[model samples]
Target: AEAYPKVKRNSKFKVLDAADIDFFRSILSSDELVESRSPEELASFNQDWMKKYRGQSNLVLLPNSTEKVSKIMKYCNDNKLAVVPQGGNTDLVGASVPVFDEIILSLKNMNRIRDFDSVSGTFKCDAGVVMRDAHKFLHDHDHIFPLDLPSRNNCHVGGVVSTNAGGLNLLRYGSLHGNVLGLEVVLPNGEIISSINALRKDNTGYDLKQLFIGAEGTIGIITGVSILAAAKPKALNAIFCGIDNFDTVQDLFVKAKGELSEILSAFEFMDRGSIECTIDYLKGLPFPLENHHNFYVLIETSGSNKRHDDEKLSAFLSSALDAKLLSEGVMAKDKADYDRIWTWRKSVPPACNSYGGMYKYDMSLQLKDLYSVSEAVTKRLNEAGLIGDAPKPIVKSVGYGHVGDGNIHLNIAVREFTKEIENLLEPFVYEYIASKKGSISAEHGVGFHKRGHLHYSRSDIEIRFMKDVKRHYDPNGILNPYKYI
Candidate 1:
């Protein structure tokens, strides 16, 4: 770290050179690893899914097995190498991306399903196994994992466990943290903790595996995970309901909790901008109406029987429509229509990205306070001439997300804006989130990008406790350092 100008020796993996890569080649399988120092690949790999925090990486390491990771970690521990363990590389923040072209340990080659206990319905997959693959794996059996999301098509289990990822199903099935029973993690000191106990109640000391979840690879590498699978709902029902007002949708959420508690699996919102972008990017997929709505909700439910589920959803929508809560609503006739309705919501971020640059002010507040915050920020941005610069019919920004969990993916797009405006918007957005006593990072972890603003969500005492935990687990400070602090 002292040798490099800006690099810090925070993690156990070292930034190795071409010669360094040559040194490790003999000890490991030659085909699985690559010593990528090229500017193009490094630049591509250094960025995140959001493309907000692009970084520089020196060498990218690909280890195929837990034993290989163990050996690599041991070697890094001895040589003072700082490592950034990465999976899938689909995180919104720069969690998996290298900070300054330091050595990167890619888990892509480690994809495998190590074991599956049918009796307990527990499945353990390698860190590099993509999420969609896991879904297929479960499909091959007669079971399905309850966790579902837009990213499930690409996200991996390792990254999911590392970030404690929550999705639409989180409202019902709960986060992965509660489902994951055991973990096999390679500690910063190069030791493996393989406790594959699938028992529900283990009064084990400390419940150490919890540390790796949502730690963003700062604590250690989650090589493998054991999680309990859930019974698949036999009857799947998807609904796309259009309401003129966003407030009515919020009201519907409160009422639905009382009325359809068990059937309401996911309650998500799609702003007008999100809808238009989906239409624009995905081609002639209609927005389910003659005109656009202020906010749309894609509500879905899974029940024991399709007839009962469809009847209940239809009855629910009828009540809402009769009450003039929504202009129109449709329950999916089949799986194909169900997937089409979801495309409008699932493809928002990607479509938005194709436009140009974007800045995300993701935060978690009281669901009641979410719209008000968005309104206030939208008003402020308009006042600052951020969007007012354009000609007539300026492109109005949009903000919407998992209303069920109070996590909002608020974003701002300026066709051409100054760095000064960027500076102004950052404080305006984060400060408002702070005033609400909300989380600065709702879904995205505090990995490098949001660490500076952690104080907005956590207190001094809580932060101190977190640092202390990091110290206790990795006293050498050789873990993914300078992150999530």
Candidate 2:
């Protein structure tokens, strides 16, 4: 590794004592920081779920408390070291895994539920708090932290807040942006600013706490958060509807949304290829719908009560069925049935990867232009001789996301990972997104993966503003120095 030279006005910060390993060890538990002396020890967090970025910088630092993280940050700040904060490491863009010259700050050790307020409907937990664990915490207290995702068990609250992540329930409950009430942040200078007050309204001054919410920890490390929980719906009804074309699918979606407002928790679509992949991955978990169909939608509704919710859901489905807006429809009768319907939607990513290598792109675009942009991207890639090629990133499978919220997740599969493919696909995808007045990053923030794509989503003025923010908060460029802005 290269030396950590003095770079800025605050360049007198001390470099870490790699020789005095015990100094670092005292900040963590015995099981916290693990280096690879053996293959089995390194296998757990070595390879991230994202297959594209698979390099290793495994000086993994796992601090158990905010104080420990603060101390580590203070040390790193003094040394002008860049720290990559990770939780569960379930990131798709390879942001969780590090490049060659950085140390990993794994938040897996700090997961702990601090408080549960049923009356106010807020849950305070450490950043490493797993979504699934929070769900169970809510169930125990008659509440739930609403940031739902497929990797609920693995992805932690810290990562979710850092990414300002969006998932299936985003259509109804809104993403982390809306539901998060407060946060406890670790600034780049190792100072702890506790915003976990759980107040619904605080119009004292500039809402400065928000800047780090989606900054992806490049500006600072988020130690814990206080989230406003969405009350758990008494009943959940899921339906699988297959459409023949994108136009028809769009029409049906508009109609369904026109009728149902917040009850429409999820409106995810599954391509035939994605459906088949799920069926293959889990033997008994059949696709539950026709594979030949060009597009399939798994619409889910969660209402305040069961019987009343079902009646309203039935009316919506019956009307759609009679209107011929849907080619097929199957309503879930039980929990098992609903899970079966969801398998198709969640399999979209794994399907894109399992079949071959993959390039995953998630964008925030106008709902009307979602499918249209996909078509355009595919056409442009085809013209560039990248779409149908064997070892290039090919737009082979397309799925639906928080269609109700205008966030779509699309994937391209190839036989191998190559710099050439990224070079070609990036400009093509990002430029098209910009053309459509869309953001290159929808839920996922601009980490290393989307650093180059920032200009596409941002204006010249916006880019300069972001640079100013970086300048003010991290003038030394010591906080995750090569990421975001």
Candidate 3:
């Protein structure tokens, strides 16, 4: 894997010592403290999910309650010790892991469902609650969390809110900015700020809670969340299609929206390269369609009535087929079929890494130019003689992502991670997005991986404003140093 990017440690922060550990132990139980003296014990906490970044932290604190988190923050701030607040450690961009010797403030122990109002669809929970567990709680109450991700089983609710994650269902339920009612956060100096209300319409001053959403924990650590849950659909169906090209994919999407309308929940895109890699990784798994095409699309619908949803989907498929928009297609007729179809879509990322290493870029671009960047990068790699059989640096570059939100995930699988390959992609990818007036990051936050590349997406004034906000809330820069803006 590629080496962790080099960044100078901030001189203002203090190194961990016995006194610090003793102070933490005073407020927390023995189970809550993990003295990272053993490399094996801290391996998972220090390294990121992608195995691309690593840190050498000496201490990890797990607080079960907001009050305990407040106490730990107060002590760390008083001693000028930098801290990295971690949750689940499932962040693809290295946002949840420490960059250096910064102490890790993990919230894994805080996984608790605080309250739920079935009538109003308002659910409250501790920030460390696993998303899948929260979703199960809501599901039993005939409601569902507004967000859905493949990593739901492992990702923490607080991490999703902090990153402002946009997942498969974003096309339907909307973003956390619109669904989250309130957040309870702990400020840098250990002050508790609670706005965890269940009000749907509160025209309050400034909507201050929004600042922490998508802030990536640079300003404060989110401890509790109150969000408006959506009612679970009684009937759901999915369809996978093979399209002739990107143009037909767009046409099919517009048609699906017009025909499927209210019941449509997700629209995902996968290029041929992505499909091929996924199939290769699956090892002898049959393709969904009779023949392979240049591109594929997955469309899902959810509704209250099974008959109505089935009719709508059937009619939409008939119309699309009549228009010659799809080369071939398969619709889920049973729950097993639905699950199998989603597996095909979700398996694309892991498949990209089958080659050994993968460089992933999540971006937001206009639908018209969504796949162009991937094509260009592939061409660039080919021109540099990096793509080929054995001994070649790159195996393939694939493109796929959520079509509803104008997001695209470009993955380049290589024999191994190398500086030359990274250098070839960095500014080129960022500049391409900037030229298209697109965001360098669509859903992923500008964590340590993308921190230096913020200028490619944000104007100087906007970056200055972000830095100003960071300094205003965390003057000591002790919270999540060397991350975000």
Candidate 4:
């Protein structure tokens, strides 16, 4: 297991014992309980998808219903045992997995679709339902979930909701905070509080559901979700274009928003370093362009009229080319090509990791200065003699993300995970983000990884209020202890 030297297990939280296991076995079926005796089965539950953060959890409970979850939480709270609420276990930050001997409460068994109102375009489902499954279900009904991401197949709706993941379709559908209507969350003390409703407008007191949307399960475990869905677009088109520089990328984005307007679904940006790393990792995947450029942009449009969308996209591309904003471009010929083009953008993170390790920072900066951070980081690492060919700890610093949202994913791919490399990035990256008056974490929640660095993005008063909220919800700090404020 990887060690988090800065954090120690809270003495207030009790260690798991035979009595707790027996109590859990009585409430849950044999299949739902996974004890550490079968380490093989518990392995995946303890490690994160990135394989960078790991836990030494001794037991895992897979509750099939909210009632079962409530019972387990009540007992754990009374016993002062810490618990980690997990779904899909696909979180990049160290939030989903336990840092120490905390018990794992996996939501995999709660996979169920409660209801869907086609007329209202509202969907209600258990938190454990996979995102891909939800998308497929909505597609059949001529409706679509407002959220879309590269990890749709593996990530659960609950996981995405908990992380408040801003994905590829965020430009079109906005964020989960706006799309999600309500939630059924299990508070740390085992109380199941529900704000689940299909109505779009309800100005009754506080919208408590919003708290759990990106809480990372620190105060509660989300068992069900009620979210707004959009009508499936009748037509969809995607284009991959190469740009000469970041300025051109910004100009093209403005042009896309003005020309494509309502039809524009996504505008993603990738720098030369990102493209080179992807190329090296993919190793001849037949890139979209005949030649490489300093930057790449993937644009997509979705609307009810195919002819109108095509004409708008065509006109936009022509003007962009004439203005020299785009050096080269290619429109996806079909669905297969569309998926292939998206792969080039989505495969960046894992591709960078293929070399060895990746130090990822999901940051939000001013549009004009978005790409500058990548350039500055690359130059800094290169000057430090840490980034280069082989035999060096650092491989390269690459940047790519949803430029329309002003979110940039700065990745420092390295030969291995070393303290020295992290030391070089840490306070430096956070401080830079602070200086820009940007968020240290754009979409990814402040997990165990960024818990201590909240000051970079939040003021002392804001953090104090957050801590107060945590205390009001989980007074014992039993829910996801030693993390998140």
Please give the clash total of every predicted structure, in order. 12, 3, 0, 0
Score residue 400 of candidate 2 by CA lDDT.
Answer: 55
Better of 1 and 3 by TM-score: 3
Candidate 2 per-residue C-alpha lDDT over 360-394 given as tens digits, one digit per residue, 9 for 90 to 100:
78888887788766676556557777655455456
The regions of model 4 sitting more than 4 angstroms off are none
Cα RMSDs, all models: 3.2, 3.7, 1.1, 1.1
CA lDDT of each prediction against the hidden true structure: 0.76, 0.74, 0.90, 0.90
RMSD in angstroms, candidate 3?
Answer: 1.1
Can you give the TM-score per candidate against the true fold?
0.93, 0.91, 0.98, 0.98
Look at candidate 2 and give me any clashing residue pairs.
Answer: 13-78, 14-78, 127-158
Candidate 3 residue lDDT tens string, 1-485: 34554778888789888888888888989989898658878988998877888888988899999999999888888999999999888888888888889999998999999999989999999999999999999999999999998788889999999999999999999999999999999999999998897499888678899999999999999999999999999999999999988988988989988889999999999999999899988888777788888999999999999999998898888788888998888889899889888988988988887788789999999999999999989998888888888899898999999999999999998888887888889889999999999999999888988978888889999999999999999989999988866
Off by over 4 Å in 2: 1-20, 36-46, 381-395
Could you give candidate 1's per-residue lDDT for residues 1-485 as a string of tens digits? 01223345444444566566766786677765665547676665667776666556666778888988988887776777777788878787667876665567888888999887777788888988898988888877756775776788778888888988787778888877789988999987888987665477788588888878899988788898888877667877777877787779888888777777798888888777767767877887766666678888888887788888889888888888898888878888899888888887888877766655566667898887877777887787677665643541224467878888888887665444346556667777778998998888877677866766777888899888888988776766666666665
Task: State in Å the error of residue 235, model 4.
Answer: 1.0
lDDT of model 2, residue 371: 74
Model 2 TM-score, all chains together = 0.91
